[model samples]
Target: MNTAKSTLVACCQLAPKIGDLAYNRSLTERAIRSAALRGAQVVVLPELVQSGYLFADRNEALALAETRDGPTLRLWQALARELNLVVVGGFCEHLGGDDLANSAALIDAQGVRAVYRKAHLWDAEKEIFTAGSEAPPVIETVHGRIGMLICYDLEFPEWVRLPALAGADLLCAPVNWPDGPRPQTERPAEVLRVQANASVNRLFIAACDRYGHERGVGWVQGSVIVDADGYPVAGPAEQGGEQILLATLNLAEARNKRISERNDLHRDRRPHLYGMDSSLD
Candidate 1:
């Protein structure tokens, strides 16, 4: 009996219309159901996918934001129960009294397990969303220990470290990587960052990105599922349109953070020497 622990993870890279709450919800519903049909134990979607990115102004963003109990989350919760798969997707969070956040929810068969708000804001996001002060939440699911984060939050190694340190086997990031200039025939720098983060933590990472130009902005469409060794198992997508990338990951691999026999990834950490206002966490 080969009992190696593994799970099929899917990154549903699709475009969500700006300010079209109904359309976005329908888009995600299709993607989630499709992923579940394809044997995905976990499905991930793009950043701010509940509404869309590139809001015209605060008024526009506020109009699109949804509370946790809103229709979108309710639909996701229903799907999670019916399909019995984990869903990690981003949304424009309405944090009562006009405050908004770039948030992602982790849901399983039981219900909405956790909601992580984006801590690091990107360009225009600083103007519209309130940055979350809370650290990323790691929840134990039937598949494995799962952690959640949104786009720019993945850029901060310290932030990613928190979940890994807390014993998360996999990290799901919902991203909307705007198209940017890079060298010809080279991978997107954003994709490279996901690989780097996974390797450092020896944790599996699934980052789902969006496509379709939104309000004059094009996206990278670099959805990917990387293994603990930092290599792409599914995709850094072809950069065309929408795509569904899937990979089966050995969740047990993350438990052994050994690159070399003597060098353990977490055990060899020199954090105390890295200068901080520490009571030595």
Candidate 2:
């Protein structure tokens, strides 16, 4: 296996206006260019970046949704080629007919590499989008094996573990975190969850979240980049503003899931003893 020496990852936190495709595209493009100029090999943007979140209804979401070969993604493909970097971001995906899915696409110089539809829908999203059936795939790239999940998927431990078992070096999460209570000194609970997931999997996690209020909904702007040890390397950025968090990660280190000589996060799993049948009952 060809392990990456080191890869610079960036998470872009920006507020997208609801129903404003052009403005969102401009913001996304500028962020991508800026991150690329800063030597980021992989740049991740917030969920529903092009179409924005907080849609009023299913009809409104469908109006903003784009197909896989749509203009927004085409622009990303062009930028990926020009910048020679990988870009991962979320969008409202049109799945033909009346179907729409909240999806994230991984784009590189060669074009769209993989697309992951959000498997778990949250709140009003359940009313506007269809849940994706497939799990995120581990994609091979020059930098490393990349996996993806959207906002709510990160909450599921099984979802995170699947990618780790598949040998993913990095997990990109495009999120639109809703506002919630947090302690004065402690990080947001969502940020802590990503850190724990990254630490347990021994992989890097870059969560790109948006800030500000949209359509009467407030967001938690706790974008972060966590290393294999489950510590924040870059953010937990301030709320209600745009920010970019950058960090260089050793992809090779993620391949080592062993905490010590006797323990391995992956190898030590006792699936047989977990009683899957009983859990189902």
Candidate 3:
């Protein structure tokens, strides 16, 4: 039997229907229970897994947006406590009145820990949601120190660096990657970026993506769990439609930043020089 240092992580790649809150909630409950049965201590679901992507309009998105105390998150909190697992998933957040946000919640047995709103809006999302201003949240859990972020946010290396610097051992990302053209025999760039982020930060990353076409749009369905070395310990799950990807990680390994015994990834960074006229991000 393995020890406590190992954390079993799972990425549930499901196809959520648009504008159907009840169905999405039920689907996530099932997925969470199933992952728990399979020994997943950290379970991740796709971005907007609670509300689905591809809103026809802001009205539809607003209709789907829910508060932190909404039913979906409430269910997750219950499941996290009952199954004794950490859940990181996404939803369309209702921010009072007419404002809405694309956000994710980090919940453990103690209940909702942190909510991260997508800081970088994508495409039509600009019109439908308000971009978040805060950085990704990192929290300590029974399993390990875990951090969270959403899709598209992964594209910025600078942003991903924040959680790593905060002493997070694992970073959970909920993404809904729209399908696009790429080399047929090669891997998707989406998966490649997850690996790059993991290796560069010396942190483990679990990215869960959704599948199926919505409003003539198909996704990469690329749910993955990457190790600190940037290699996949579980899945790329690209094109694998509706599935769960799991990997048991020794989260403690991420603490060691040594690559060649001489070079350290974090210590070597020179961000102060990256800015224009010494004032930059």
Candidate 4:
């Protein structure tokens, strides 16, 4: 409970091959162990890491998903307990009755603590994955009060704002962004968007993105760890190879940055003005 002590978090970026659950899980476990060895209290992996993004059809995608407490989760739970580490990662979830969700799980030293289905699906996600009705949960762990977001969720400022409003000090992301096959100029904008979110919110943002080539889609490599100041501590801005970026955070400092009454975005929000935007179909 010493907010003054620094917290260490790791971003585990990978180029997970699509449809390779076993391989991806193994890779994840390895990353977790490696991060723990490096003294990270929490390790974050990219979204849908278990299954390489095979978005060819709904049936194919659903076939590869599982419940939050299914076999895959059990494995992660065991690993988390054994390593005494907290993990946040993305996965394709089978909620039941033929429904599917693009979800993120927060597993701590004890077990899977929370599951957040992506609420705002982007592009093809709208067609394949069901959007979650609930908001992002701010989870309190041995690490800190953490906010969880996945991939495109970072594109929306509101996605990060809600958790910060709920007293989150750290924001963890698990992403699988494909290379638009464009030049570098096009990619920095996306990266800057995430950094801007971190800076404006005054919260540490740890983003782990999938790298390498999969299903003919290349990735914009970089698994980044941005401080509360909205600056990357380490990792690539371009495509990341399998790697880990480690950084320490003091949430107490982040909490102080937004303390002013006048500049408090968390307290100054006008809900009446916000409902119009939320009502969009």
Highest TM-score: which candidate?
Answer: 1
Predictions: Cα RMSD each:
1.6, 2.4, 2.3, 3.0
* Ten contiguous residues with the weakest lDDT in model 4: 272-281
- Cand. 4 Cα-lDDT: 0.81
Question: In model 2, which regions exceed 4 Å deviation?
Answer: 1-4, 276-281
Task: Compose the digit string of candidate 1's lDDT tens values, residues 1-281.
Answer: 12396799999999999989999999999999999999999999999899999999999999989998999999999999999999999999999999999999999999889999999999999999999999999999887889998888888999999999898899999999988899989998899999999999999999999998899999998999999989999998958589899999988788889899799888788777876445434
Off by over 4 Å in 1: 1-3, 277-281
253: Cα error in model 4, Å = 1.8
Candidate 3 residue runs with Cα over 4 Å from true position: 1-4, 276-281
Instruction: For model 1, name the residue pairs that clash.
Output: none
List the candidates' TM-scores in order. Answer: 0.97, 0.96, 0.96, 0.91
Ten residues in a row with the worst lDDT in model 3?
A: 272-281
Q: Write the per-residue lDDT of candidate 3 for residues 1-281, one digit (tens) a residue.
A: 22347889999999999988999999999999999999999999999999889999999999889999999999999999999999999999999999999999999999999999999999999999999999898898887789999999999988898889888899999999999999899899999999999999899999999997899999998899999999999889879999999999999888888898799988877877876233332
- Candidate closer to the true structure by lDDT (higher is better), 1 or 2: 1
**What lDDT score belongs to each candidate, Candidate 1 first?**
0.92, 0.91, 0.92, 0.81
Count clashes in each candidate, considering only residues at least 3 apart in sequence or on different chains. Answer: 0, 0, 0, 6
Please, what are the lDDT tens digits per residue for candidate 4 over residues 1-281? 57788888898887777777788888888888899999988889888987777578898888789898776678789888998888898889998888899998999877889999998887888888889988888998876788898888889897778787777888888887776745645546557777888887788888888877766777777678887777888664466477888888776666755546567644456666767454331
Tens digit per residue, CA lDDT, model 2, 243-263: 889999888889998999899
